[model samples]
Target: MLVNMKKILEIAEAEGYAIPCINTPNEETVRAVIGAAEELNTPIIIDHAQVHDSLIPIERIGPIMLKYAKEARVPVCVHLDHGSDYEFVMRAVKVGFPSIMYDCSALPFEENVEKVAQFVKFAHAAGITVEAELGIMASTDEDTHDDDPEKRVLTNEDIREFFTEPAEAKEFAERTKCDALAVCFGTMHGIYAEPPVLDIDRVKELREAIPDDTRIVMHGASGVEFDQVQNAITAGCSKVNYYSYMAKATTKFVADKVAETDGKIAYHELQEAAYEFMKGYAKDVIKAFKNGK
Candidate 1:
Protein backbone atom coordinates (compact mmCIF):
# COMPACT_ATOMS: atom_id res chain seq x y z
CA MET A 1 0.00 0.00 0.00
CA LEU A 2 1.11 3.58 -0.69
CA VAL A 3 2.17 5.32 2.56
CA ASN A 4 4.11 8.29 3.84
CA MET A 5 7.54 8.17 5.52
CA LYS A 6 6.10 9.53 8.74
CA LYS A 7 3.88 6.51 9.35
CA ILE A 8 6.35 4.00 7.94
CA LEU A 9 9.18 5.26 10.17
CA GLU A 10 7.07 5.82 13.24
CA ILE A 11 6.38 2.10 13.34
CA ALA A 12 10.08 1.37 12.78
CA GLU A 13 11.10 3.67 15.64
CA ALA A 14 8.60 2.17 18.02
CA GLU A 15 9.40 -1.38 17.06
CA GLY A 16 13.20 -0.94 17.32
CA TYR A 17 13.89 -1.81 13.69
CA ALA A 18 14.85 0.19 10.62
CA ILE A 19 13.30 0.33 7.13
CA PRO A 20 15.49 0.39 4.05
CA CYS A 21 15.26 3.34 1.69
CA ILE A 22 16.46 1.98 -1.62
CA ASN A 23 16.93 4.07 -4.75
CA THR A 24 15.78 2.78 -8.15
CA PRO A 25 16.47 4.26 -11.54
CA ASN A 26 14.55 1.74 -13.64
CA GLU A 27 11.79 -0.84 -13.67
CA GLU A 28 14.07 -3.77 -12.93
CA THR A 29 15.35 -2.20 -9.73
CA VAL A 30 11.85 -1.05 -8.79
CA ARG A 31 10.48 -4.55 -9.17
CA ALA A 32 13.37 -5.97 -7.16
CA VAL A 33 12.74 -3.65 -4.21
CA ILE A 34 8.99 -4.10 -4.17
CA GLY A 35 9.27 -7.84 -4.68
CA ALA A 36 11.79 -8.11 -1.88
CA ALA A 37 9.60 -6.13 0.49
CA GLU A 38 6.68 -8.41 -0.34
CA GLU A 39 8.72 -11.54 0.35
CA LEU A 40 9.96 -10.12 3.65
CA ASN A 41 6.60 -8.53 4.50
CA THR A 42 8.30 -5.25 5.43
CA PRO A 43 7.84 -1.57 4.69
CA ILE A 44 10.28 0.08 2.22
CA ILE A 45 11.13 3.43 0.72
CA ILE A 46 11.81 3.66 -3.04
CA ASP A 47 13.59 6.87 -4.03
CA HIS A 48 14.99 8.53 -7.15
CA ALA A 49 17.76 11.09 -6.84
CA GLN A 50 16.95 14.33 -8.63
CA VAL A 51 20.44 14.51 -10.18
CA HIS A 52 19.59 11.35 -12.09
CA ASP A 53 16.53 12.90 -13.70
CA SER A 54 18.23 12.90 -17.10
CA LEU A 55 18.74 9.15 -16.92
CA ILE A 56 15.39 8.32 -15.27
CA PRO A 57 12.98 11.15 -15.74
CA ILE A 58 10.71 11.67 -12.72
CA GLU A 59 7.76 12.22 -15.02
CA ARG A 60 8.12 8.64 -16.30
CA ILE A 61 9.45 6.94 -13.16
CA GLY A 62 6.95 8.41 -10.70
CA PRO A 63 3.83 6.79 -12.11
CA ILE A 64 5.49 3.39 -12.35
CA MET A 65 6.63 3.69 -8.74
CA LEU A 66 3.12 4.55 -7.62
CA LYS A 67 1.78 1.57 -9.54
CA TYR A 68 4.28 -0.74 -7.83
CA ALA A 69 3.51 0.67 -4.39
CA LYS A 70 -0.24 0.28 -4.90
CA GLU A 71 0.11 -3.31 -6.04
CA ALA A 72 2.64 -4.38 -3.41
CA ARG A 73 1.29 -6.29 -0.40
CA VAL A 74 3.68 -4.45 1.95
CA PRO A 75 3.70 -0.73 2.64
CA VAL A 76 5.84 1.35 0.24
CA CYS A 77 6.76 5.02 0.19
CA VAL A 78 7.75 6.70 -3.10
CA HIS A 79 10.28 9.42 -2.34
CA LEU A 80 12.45 12.01 -4.10
CA ASP A 81 16.07 11.89 -2.82
CA HIS A 82 18.66 14.65 -2.56
CA GLY A 83 16.52 17.10 -4.48
CA SER A 84 18.51 20.36 -4.51
CA ASP A 85 16.77 22.03 -7.39
CA TYR A 86 13.52 23.73 -6.44
CA GLU A 87 11.84 23.19 -9.80
CA PHE A 88 12.65 19.48 -9.82
CA VAL A 89 11.31 19.18 -6.24
CA MET A 90 8.09 20.78 -7.42
CA ARG A 91 7.92 18.35 -10.31
CA ALA A 92 8.37 15.40 -7.95
CA VAL A 93 5.62 16.75 -5.69
CA LYS A 94 3.36 17.14 -8.74
CA VAL A 95 4.17 13.57 -9.68
CA GLY A 96 2.61 12.58 -6.30
CA PHE A 97 5.58 11.09 -4.46
CA PRO A 98 4.57 10.48 -0.84
CA SER A 99 7.86 12.01 0.40
CA ILE A 100 10.52 14.49 -0.80
CA MET A 101 14.03 15.10 0.66
CA TYR A 102 15.16 18.67 -0.05
CA ASP A 103 18.92 18.54 0.50
CA CYS A 104 20.17 21.99 1.43
CA SER A 105 23.01 20.78 3.64
CA ALA A 106 25.55 22.51 1.41
CA LEU A 107 24.21 25.92 2.40
CA PRO A 108 24.71 27.93 5.58
CA PHE A 109 22.84 26.51 8.55
CA GLU A 110 20.26 29.26 8.72
CA GLU A 111 19.78 29.22 4.97
CA ASN A 112 19.37 25.46 4.99
CA VAL A 113 16.66 25.80 7.60
CA GLU A 114 14.88 28.54 5.66
CA LYS A 115 15.01 26.70 2.33
CA VAL A 116 13.84 23.40 3.75
CA ALA A 117 11.14 25.12 5.74
CA GLN A 118 9.73 26.51 2.50
CA PHE A 119 9.80 23.03 0.97
CA VAL A 120 8.17 21.56 4.07
CA LYS A 121 5.38 24.09 3.88
CA PHE A 122 4.82 23.42 0.20
CA ALA A 123 5.01 19.65 0.56
CA HIS A 124 2.79 19.50 3.64
CA ALA A 125 0.16 21.58 1.89
CA ALA A 126 0.03 18.78 -0.72
CA GLY A 127 -0.17 16.10 2.03
CA ILE A 128 3.42 14.88 1.51
CA THR A 129 6.08 14.37 4.19
CA VAL A 130 9.48 16.09 3.92
CA GLU A 131 12.95 14.76 4.83
CA ALA A 132 15.70 17.34 5.26
CA GLU A 133 19.44 16.81 5.49
CA LEU A 134 21.55 18.69 8.07
CA GLY A 135 25.11 17.70 7.09
CA ILE A 136 27.46 17.42 4.13
CA MET A 137 27.86 14.09 2.35
CA ALA A 138 30.92 13.68 0.15
CA SER A 139 30.34 12.71 -3.48
CA THR A 140 30.81 8.97 -3.73
CA ASP A 141 30.73 8.45 -7.51
CA GLU A 142 34.34 8.02 -8.60
CA ASP A 143 33.43 8.49 -12.24
CA THR A 144 32.27 12.05 -11.58
CA HIS A 145 35.53 13.30 -10.07
CA ASP A 146 37.88 15.68 -11.88
CA ASP A 147 41.43 14.68 -12.94
CA ASP A 148 43.10 17.92 -11.89
CA PRO A 149 43.27 17.63 -8.11
CA GLU A 150 42.10 14.05 -7.89
CA LYS A 151 39.81 12.90 -5.09
CA ARG A 152 41.18 13.23 -1.58
CA VAL A 153 40.20 11.06 1.34
CA LEU A 154 37.56 12.52 3.64
CA THR A 155 39.26 14.31 6.54
CA ASN A 156 38.36 14.68 10.20
CA GLU A 157 38.00 18.41 9.62
CA ASP A 158 35.32 17.75 7.08
CA ILE A 159 33.43 15.49 9.46
CA ARG A 160 33.56 17.92 12.33
CA GLU A 161 32.24 20.73 10.17
CA PHE A 162 29.38 18.74 8.66
CA PHE A 163 28.44 16.21 11.30
CA THR A 164 25.12 17.12 12.88
CA GLU A 165 25.24 18.10 16.53
CA PRO A 166 22.43 16.73 18.67
CA ALA A 167 21.18 20.20 19.57
CA GLU A 168 21.43 21.36 15.98
CA ALA A 169 19.49 18.33 14.81
CA LYS A 170 16.74 19.13 17.30
CA GLU A 171 16.66 22.75 16.17
CA PHE A 172 16.68 21.82 12.50
CA ALA A 173 13.81 19.37 12.95
CA GLU A 174 11.79 21.90 14.89
CA ARG A 175 12.58 24.75 12.51
CA THR A 176 11.84 22.85 9.32
CA LYS A 177 9.03 20.74 10.75
CA CYS A 178 10.37 17.84 8.71
CA ASP A 179 9.10 14.32 9.26
CA ALA A 180 12.54 12.68 9.00
CA LEU A 181 16.13 13.78 9.65
CA ALA A 182 19.20 12.47 7.73
CA VAL A 183 22.30 12.78 9.92
CA CYS A 184 25.98 12.53 8.97
CA PHE A 185 27.74 9.96 11.12
CA GLY A 186 31.10 9.43 9.32
CA THR A 187 29.98 7.04 6.59
CA MET A 188 30.80 8.35 3.12
CA HIS A 189 28.82 7.22 0.11
CA GLY A 190 29.94 4.46 -2.29
CA ILE A 191 32.79 1.99 -1.86
CA TYR A 192 34.93 2.48 1.20
CA ALA A 193 38.63 1.73 0.87
CA GLU A 194 39.66 2.05 4.54
CA PRO A 195 36.51 0.62 6.09
CA PRO A 196 33.71 2.82 7.41
CA VAL A 197 33.37 3.80 11.04
CA LEU A 198 29.96 4.65 12.54
CA ASP A 199 29.43 6.61 15.76
CA ILE A 200 26.54 4.85 17.41
CA ASP A 201 26.80 7.14 20.42
CA ARG A 202 26.11 10.11 18.15
CA VAL A 203 23.01 8.36 16.90
CA LYS A 204 21.74 7.99 20.46
CA GLU A 205 22.25 11.67 21.13
CA LEU A 206 20.39 12.64 17.98
CA ARG A 207 17.50 10.36 18.88
CA GLU A 208 17.16 11.93 22.30
CA ALA A 209 17.35 15.44 20.83
CA ILE A 210 14.76 15.19 18.08
CA PRO A 211 11.06 14.86 18.67
CA ASP A 212 9.84 11.33 19.27
CA ASP A 213 7.71 11.57 16.14
CA THR A 214 10.54 12.81 13.89
CA ARG A 215 12.33 9.74 12.60
CA ILE A 216 16.12 9.49 12.36
CA VAL A 217 17.59 8.64 8.93
CA MET A 218 21.08 7.51 7.98
CA HIS A 219 22.56 8.38 4.58
CA GLY A 220 25.45 6.48 2.88
CA ALA A 221 24.43 3.19 4.48
CA SER A 222 25.28 0.94 1.53
CA GLY A 223 28.81 -0.13 2.47
CA VAL A 224 28.80 0.36 6.22
CA GLU A 225 29.58 -2.54 8.52
CA PHE A 226 26.40 -4.46 9.29
CA ASP A 227 27.31 -4.60 12.98
CA GLN A 228 27.46 -0.83 13.03
CA VAL A 229 24.08 -0.74 11.35
CA GLN A 230 22.69 -2.97 14.07
CA ASN A 231 24.16 -0.70 16.68
CA ALA A 232 22.62 2.35 15.05
CA ILE A 233 19.23 0.70 14.85
CA THR A 234 19.52 -0.23 18.48
CA ALA A 235 20.42 3.36 19.20
CA GLY A 236 17.19 4.57 17.59
CA CYS A 237 17.83 5.04 13.88
CA SER A 238 14.61 4.17 12.08
CA LYS A 239 15.48 4.64 8.40
CA VAL A 240 18.61 3.95 6.36
CA ASN A 241 19.22 4.98 2.72
CA TYR A 242 21.14 2.54 0.50
CA TYR A 243 21.84 2.25 -3.26
CA SER A 244 25.45 2.20 -4.49
CA TYR A 245 26.17 -1.38 -3.47
CA MET A 246 22.98 -2.52 -5.18
CA ALA A 247 24.10 -0.92 -8.45
CA LYS A 248 27.57 -2.42 -8.18
CA ALA A 249 26.25 -5.88 -7.39
CA THR A 250 23.69 -5.84 -10.18
CA THR A 251 26.18 -4.56 -12.78
CA LYS A 252 28.78 -7.15 -11.83
CA PHE A 253 26.26 -9.96 -12.16
CA VAL A 254 25.04 -8.71 -15.54
CA ALA A 255 28.56 -8.29 -16.90
CA ASP A 256 29.66 -11.74 -15.68
CA LYS A 257 26.59 -13.33 -17.22
CA VAL A 258 27.22 -11.59 -20.55
CA ALA A 259 30.78 -12.93 -20.56
CA GLU A 260 29.57 -16.40 -19.61
CA THR A 261 27.13 -16.37 -22.55
CA ASP A 262 29.76 -14.92 -24.90
CA GLY A 263 27.52 -11.85 -25.37
CA LYS A 264 24.82 -13.79 -27.17
CA ILE A 265 21.93 -12.98 -24.79
CA ALA A 266 19.42 -10.26 -25.63
CA TYR A 267 19.51 -6.95 -23.74
CA HIS A 268 16.22 -7.71 -22.04
CA GLU A 269 17.51 -11.06 -20.85
CA LEU A 270 20.59 -9.40 -19.38
CA GLN A 271 18.30 -7.01 -17.53
CA GLU A 272 16.29 -9.94 -16.22
CA ALA A 273 19.46 -11.56 -14.96
CA ALA A 274 20.43 -8.34 -13.23
CA TYR A 275 17.01 -8.13 -11.66
CA GLU A 276 17.52 -11.49 -9.99
CA PHE A 277 20.68 -10.23 -8.33
CA MET A 278 18.99 -7.01 -7.24
CA LYS A 279 16.10 -8.94 -5.74
CA GLY A 280 18.49 -11.08 -3.73
CA TYR A 281 20.44 -8.05 -2.48
CA ALA A 282 17.27 -6.15 -1.62
CA LYS A 283 15.95 -9.07 0.37
CA ASP A 284 19.19 -9.35 2.32
CA VAL A 285 19.12 -5.64 3.11
CA ILE A 286 15.49 -5.78 4.20
CA LYS A 287 16.13 -8.74 6.46
CA ALA A 288 19.20 -7.07 7.91
CA PHE A 289 17.30 -3.90 8.71
CA LYS A 290 14.41 -5.78 10.26
CA ASN A 291 16.78 -8.16 12.11
CA GLY A 292 15.02 -11.04 10.41
CA LYS A 293 11.58 -10.02 11.55
Candidate 2:
Protein backbone atom coordinates (compact mmCIF):
# COMPACT_ATOMS: atom_id res chain seq x y z
CA MET A 1 0.00 0.00 0.00
CA LEU A 2 1.14 3.52 -0.71
CA VAL A 3 1.33 5.69 2.44
CA ASN A 4 2.71 9.02 3.57
CA MET A 5 6.21 8.93 5.09
CA LYS A 6 4.90 10.19 8.44
CA LYS A 7 2.48 7.29 8.77
CA ILE A 8 5.20 4.67 8.36
CA LEU A 9 7.67 6.61 10.50
CA GLU A 10 5.17 6.89 13.35
CA ILE A 11 4.82 3.12 13.26
CA ALA A 12 8.56 2.64 13.18
CA GLU A 13 9.09 4.91 16.16
CA ALA A 14 6.51 3.06 18.19
CA GLU A 15 7.80 -0.35 17.12
CA GLY A 16 11.43 0.39 18.00
CA TYR A 17 12.79 0.20 14.45
CA ALA A 18 13.92 2.54 11.73
CA ILE A 19 12.72 2.46 8.16
CA PRO A 20 15.46 2.15 5.54
CA CYS A 21 15.17 5.06 3.08
CA ILE A 22 17.01 4.16 -0.12
CA ASN A 23 17.57 6.07 -3.32
CA THR A 24 15.91 4.47 -6.34
CA PRO A 25 16.88 6.47 -9.40
CA ASN A 26 15.91 3.82 -11.93
CA GLU A 27 13.21 1.25 -12.54
CA GLU A 28 15.37 -1.73 -11.53
CA THR A 29 16.28 -0.22 -8.15
CA VAL A 30 12.68 0.84 -7.50
CA ARG A 31 11.47 -2.70 -8.16
CA ALA A 32 14.29 -4.26 -6.15
CA VAL A 33 13.67 -2.05 -3.09
CA ILE A 34 9.92 -2.55 -3.00
CA GLY A 35 10.40 -6.26 -3.74
CA ALA A 36 12.62 -6.56 -0.67
CA ALA A 37 10.09 -4.77 1.49
CA GLU A 38 7.30 -7.04 0.26
CA GLU A 39 9.34 -10.17 0.95
CA LEU A 40 10.08 -8.98 4.47
CA ASN A 41 6.57 -7.66 5.03
CA THR A 42 8.01 -4.33 6.08
CA PRO A 43 7.39 -0.73 5.13
CA ILE A 44 10.09 0.89 3.00
CA ILE A 45 10.82 4.35 1.62
CA ILE A 46 12.09 4.75 -1.92
CA ASP A 47 13.29 8.25 -2.78
CA HIS A 48 14.32 10.17 -5.87
CA ALA A 49 17.20 12.55 -5.21
CA GLN A 50 16.97 15.95 -6.84
CA VAL A 51 20.60 15.52 -7.84
CA HIS A 52 19.55 12.57 -10.00
CA ASP A 53 17.26 14.82 -12.07
CA SER A 54 19.97 14.80 -14.73
CA LEU A 55 19.74 11.04 -14.94
CA ILE A 56 15.95 10.76 -14.86
CA PRO A 57 13.60 13.65 -14.31
CA ILE A 58 10.91 13.21 -11.66
CA GLU A 59 8.27 13.73 -14.36
CA ARG A 60 9.54 10.56 -16.01
CA ILE A 61 9.99 8.46 -12.86
CA GLY A 62 7.50 9.83 -10.35
CA PRO A 63 4.41 8.10 -11.71
CA ILE A 64 6.29 4.87 -12.08
CA MET A 65 7.38 5.04 -8.44
CA LEU A 66 3.85 5.83 -7.31
CA LYS A 67 2.42 3.02 -9.45
CA TYR A 68 4.84 0.52 -7.93
CA ALA A 69 4.16 1.83 -4.44
CA LYS A 70 0.40 1.49 -4.86
CA GLU A 71 0.80 -2.09 -6.08
CA ALA A 72 3.35 -3.23 -3.50
CA ARG A 73 2.19 -5.76 -0.92
CA VAL A 74 3.84 -3.79 1.88
CA PRO A 75 3.56 -0.06 2.51
CA VAL A 76 5.92 2.10 0.45
CA CYS A 77 6.54 5.84 0.60
CA VAL A 78 7.73 7.66 -2.50
CA HIS A 79 9.88 10.55 -1.25
CA LEU A 80 11.97 13.42 -2.56
CA ASP A 81 15.47 13.24 -1.09
CA HIS A 82 17.61 16.33 -0.56
CA GLY A 83 15.34 18.64 -2.48
CA SER A 84 17.33 21.81 -1.66
CA ASP A 85 15.75 24.18 -4.11
CA TYR A 86 12.19 25.43 -3.59
CA GLU A 87 11.27 25.02 -7.26
CA PHE A 88 12.62 21.48 -7.41
CA VAL A 89 10.73 20.52 -4.28
CA MET A 90 7.54 21.97 -5.73
CA ARG A 91 8.16 19.82 -8.76
CA ALA A 92 8.15 16.72 -6.58
CA VAL A 93 4.97 17.91 -4.90
CA LYS A 94 3.39 18.47 -8.31
CA VAL A 95 4.43 14.95 -9.30
CA GLY A 96 2.45 13.65 -6.29
CA PHE A 97 5.23 12.68 -3.94
CA PRO A 98 3.79 11.89 -0.53
CA SER A 99 6.95 12.97 1.25
CA ILE A 100 9.55 15.69 0.67
CA MET A 101 12.86 16.68 2.24
CA TYR A 102 13.09 20.44 1.88
CA ASP A 103 16.74 20.77 2.78
CA CYS A 104 17.95 24.31 3.51
CA SER A 105 20.61 23.33 6.00
CA ALA A 106 23.26 25.29 4.16
CA LEU A 107 21.49 28.51 5.03
CA PRO A 108 21.67 30.32 8.36
CA PHE A 109 19.69 28.65 11.14
CA GLU A 110 16.97 31.32 11.16
CA GLU A 111 16.63 31.25 7.40
CA ASN A 112 16.45 27.48 7.32
CA VAL A 113 13.76 27.48 9.95
CA GLU A 114 11.73 30.18 8.19
CA LYS A 115 11.87 28.44 4.82
CA VAL A 116 10.90 25.05 6.20
CA ALA A 117 8.23 26.46 8.46
CA GLN A 118 6.52 28.15 5.53
CA PHE A 119 6.75 25.03 3.39
CA VAL A 120 5.50 22.83 6.21
CA LYS A 121 2.36 24.91 6.48
CA PHE A 122 1.61 24.50 2.79
CA ALA A 123 2.62 20.84 2.81
CA HIS A 124 0.51 19.99 5.84
CA ALA A 125 -2.51 21.63 4.28
CA ALA A 126 -2.08 19.31 1.31
CA GLY A 127 -1.68 16.30 3.62
CA ILE A 128 1.94 15.75 2.57
CA THR A 129 4.72 15.10 5.06
CA VAL A 130 7.80 17.29 5.11
CA GLU A 131 11.33 16.47 6.32
CA ALA A 132 13.85 19.19 7.10
CA GLU A 133 17.56 18.96 7.77
CA LEU A 134 19.05 20.63 10.85
CA GLY A 135 22.74 20.24 10.14
CA ILE A 136 25.01 20.09 7.11
CA MET A 137 25.86 16.51 6.16
CA ALA A 138 29.28 15.97 4.69
CA SER A 139 29.70 13.97 1.52
CA THR A 140 32.49 11.88 0.08
CA ASP A 141 33.69 11.66 -3.52
CA GLU A 142 31.55 8.63 -4.17
CA ASP A 143 28.41 10.59 -3.28
CA THR A 144 27.02 11.69 -6.61
CA HIS A 145 24.35 13.75 -4.86
CA ASP A 146 27.03 16.12 -3.56
CA ASP A 147 28.41 18.17 -6.42
CA ASP A 148 31.14 19.85 -4.37
CA PRO A 149 34.32 17.81 -4.59
CA GLU A 150 35.77 19.50 -1.48
CA LYS A 151 33.32 17.63 0.74
CA ARG A 152 34.80 14.29 -0.30
CA VAL A 153 37.92 14.62 1.80
CA LEU A 154 36.26 15.54 5.08
CA THR A 155 37.31 13.22 7.87
CA ASN A 156 35.35 12.03 10.90
CA GLU A 157 36.87 14.84 12.92
CA ASP A 158 35.62 17.38 10.41
CA ILE A 159 32.13 15.94 10.57
CA ARG A 160 31.99 16.65 14.29
CA GLU A 161 31.73 20.34 13.51
CA PHE A 162 28.50 19.64 11.69
CA PHE A 163 26.83 17.63 14.45
CA THR A 164 23.36 18.87 15.31
CA GLU A 165 22.92 20.35 18.75
CA PRO A 166 20.15 18.73 20.71
CA ALA A 167 18.71 22.06 21.87
CA GLU A 168 18.75 23.47 18.35
CA ALA A 169 17.17 20.30 17.02
CA LYS A 170 14.27 20.73 19.41
CA GLU A 171 13.87 24.35 18.38
CA PHE A 172 14.04 23.54 14.69
CA ALA A 173 11.50 20.73 14.93
CA GLU A 174 9.16 22.88 17.01
CA ARG A 175 9.51 25.94 14.83
CA THR A 176 9.23 24.24 11.47
CA LYS A 177 6.65 21.65 12.45
CA CYS A 178 8.37 19.19 10.14
CA ASP A 179 7.29 15.57 10.34
CA ALA A 180 10.92 14.41 10.44
CA LEU A 181 14.24 16.15 10.96
CA ALA A 182 17.52 14.80 9.53
CA VAL A 183 20.40 15.55 11.94
CA CYS A 184 24.12 14.98 11.70
CA PHE A 185 25.80 13.10 14.52
CA GLY A 186 28.81 11.31 13.08
CA THR A 187 28.17 9.64 9.72
CA MET A 188 29.05 11.35 6.44
CA HIS A 189 27.75 10.57 2.98
CA GLY A 190 29.44 8.04 0.65
CA ILE A 191 32.46 5.85 1.56
CA TYR A 192 33.93 7.00 4.83
CA ALA A 193 37.56 8.10 4.96
CA GLU A 194 37.79 6.05 8.13
CA PRO A 195 35.35 3.74 9.88
CA PRO A 196 32.78 6.21 11.22
CA VAL A 197 31.84 6.29 14.88
CA LEU A 198 28.27 7.37 15.61
CA ASP A 199 27.51 9.67 18.50
CA ILE A 200 24.93 7.30 19.90
CA ASP A 201 24.57 9.50 22.93
CA ARG A 202 23.84 12.49 20.72
CA VAL A 203 21.11 10.53 18.99
CA LYS A 204 19.50 9.77 22.33
CA GLU A 205 19.76 13.38 23.37
CA LEU A 206 18.22 14.62 20.14
CA ARG A 207 15.42 12.11 20.45
CA GLU A 208 14.64 13.23 23.95
CA ALA A 209 14.78 16.90 23.14
CA ILE A 210 12.96 16.95 19.82
CA PRO A 211 9.16 16.97 19.76
CA ASP A 212 7.61 13.51 19.82
CA ASP A 213 5.64 14.24 16.67
CA THR A 214 8.85 14.90 14.77
CA ARG A 215 10.77 11.68 14.24
CA ILE A 216 14.56 11.85 14.22
CA VAL A 217 16.38 10.98 11.00
CA MET A 218 19.95 9.85 10.34
CA HIS A 219 21.50 10.44 6.92
CA GLY A 220 24.77 9.03 5.48
CA ALA A 221 24.16 5.63 7.03
CA SER A 222 25.66 3.68 4.12
CA GLY A 223 29.24 3.17 5.30
CA VAL A 224 28.60 2.97 9.02
CA GLU A 225 28.91 -0.41 10.75
CA PHE A 226 25.68 -2.35 11.15
CA ASP A 227 25.94 -2.46 14.93
CA GLN A 228 26.40 1.31 15.09
CA VAL A 229 23.53 1.85 12.71
CA GLN A 230 21.24 -0.31 14.80
CA ASN A 231 22.39 1.45 17.93
CA ALA A 232 21.37 4.75 16.41
CA ILE A 233 17.94 3.31 15.59
CA THR A 234 17.56 2.11 19.13
CA ALA A 235 18.67 5.47 20.42
CA GLY A 236 16.11 7.33 18.30
CA CYS A 237 16.45 7.47 14.53
CA SER A 238 13.25 6.23 12.88
CA LYS A 239 14.40 7.02 9.35
CA VAL A 240 17.83 6.06 8.04
CA ASN A 241 19.06 7.24 4.64
CA TYR A 242 21.36 4.69 3.01
CA TYR A 243 22.75 4.30 -0.52
CA SER A 244 26.29 5.06 -1.64
CA TYR A 245 27.71 1.74 -0.47
CA MET A 246 24.81 -0.24 -1.83
CA ALA A 247 25.25 1.36 -5.24
CA LYS A 248 28.98 0.66 -5.18
CA ALA A 249 28.39 -2.93 -4.17
CA THR A 250 25.88 -3.42 -6.97
CA THR A 251 28.34 -2.13 -9.56
CA LYS A 252 30.97 -4.60 -8.39
CA PHE A 253 28.46 -7.40 -8.37
CA VAL A 254 27.50 -6.72 -12.01
CA ALA A 255 31.12 -6.55 -13.04
CA ASP A 256 31.93 -9.85 -11.35
CA LYS A 257 28.88 -11.52 -12.86
CA VAL A 258 29.92 -10.47 -16.37
CA ALA A 259 33.46 -11.79 -15.77
CA GLU A 260 32.09 -15.09 -14.43
CA THR A 261 29.88 -15.46 -17.48
CA ASP A 262 32.83 -14.67 -19.79
CA GLY A 263 30.85 -11.86 -21.44
CA LYS A 264 28.25 -14.31 -22.74
CA ILE A 265 25.31 -13.02 -20.70
CA ALA A 266 22.77 -10.93 -22.59
CA TYR A 267 22.21 -7.29 -21.56
CA HIS A 268 18.69 -7.96 -20.32
CA GLU A 269 19.90 -10.95 -18.36
CA LEU A 270 22.55 -8.82 -16.71
CA GLN A 271 19.99 -6.26 -15.70
CA GLU A 272 17.74 -8.96 -14.24
CA ALA A 273 20.63 -10.45 -12.29
CA ALA A 274 21.48 -7.02 -10.89
CA TYR A 275 17.90 -6.50 -9.82
CA GLU A 276 17.86 -9.83 -8.00
CA PHE A 277 21.09 -8.96 -6.24
CA MET A 278 19.73 -5.57 -5.10
CA LYS A 279 16.53 -7.17 -3.83
CA GLY A 280 18.56 -9.34 -1.50
CA TYR A 281 20.81 -6.46 -0.54
CA ALA A 282 17.83 -4.29 0.38
CA LYS A 283 16.38 -7.10 2.47
CA ASP A 284 19.50 -7.24 4.61
CA VAL A 285 19.38 -3.47 5.02
CA ILE A 286 15.75 -3.58 6.15
CA LYS A 287 16.50 -6.37 8.61
CA ALA A 288 19.42 -4.47 10.05
CA PHE A 289 17.38 -1.31 10.55
CA LYS A 290 14.76 -3.39 12.31
CA ASN A 291 17.19 -3.57 15.25
CA GLY A 292 16.22 -7.15 16.01
CA LYS A 293 12.52 -6.29 16.05
Query: Which structure among the candidates has the greatest lDDT?
Result: 2
| Tens-place lDDT digits, model 2, residues 1-293 | 89999889988977999999999999999999999999999999999998889889999999999999999999999999999999999999999999999999999999999999999999999989999998888877444546766657777788899999999999999999999999999988777878999999999999999999999999989988999999999999999999988999999999999999999999999999999999999999999999877
Residue-by-residue lDDT tens digits, candidate 1, 10-117: 779767899999998899899999999998888899999886788979999899999999999999999999898888888988898989998888899999999999
Kindly give the stretch of ten consecutive residues in candidate 1 with the minimal lDDT sum.
Answer: 143-152
Taking all chains together, the TM-score of candidate 2 against the true structure is: 0.97
Deviation in Å, model 1, residue 125 alpha carbon: 2.5
TM-score for each model:
0.95, 0.97
RMSD of each: 1.7, 1.4
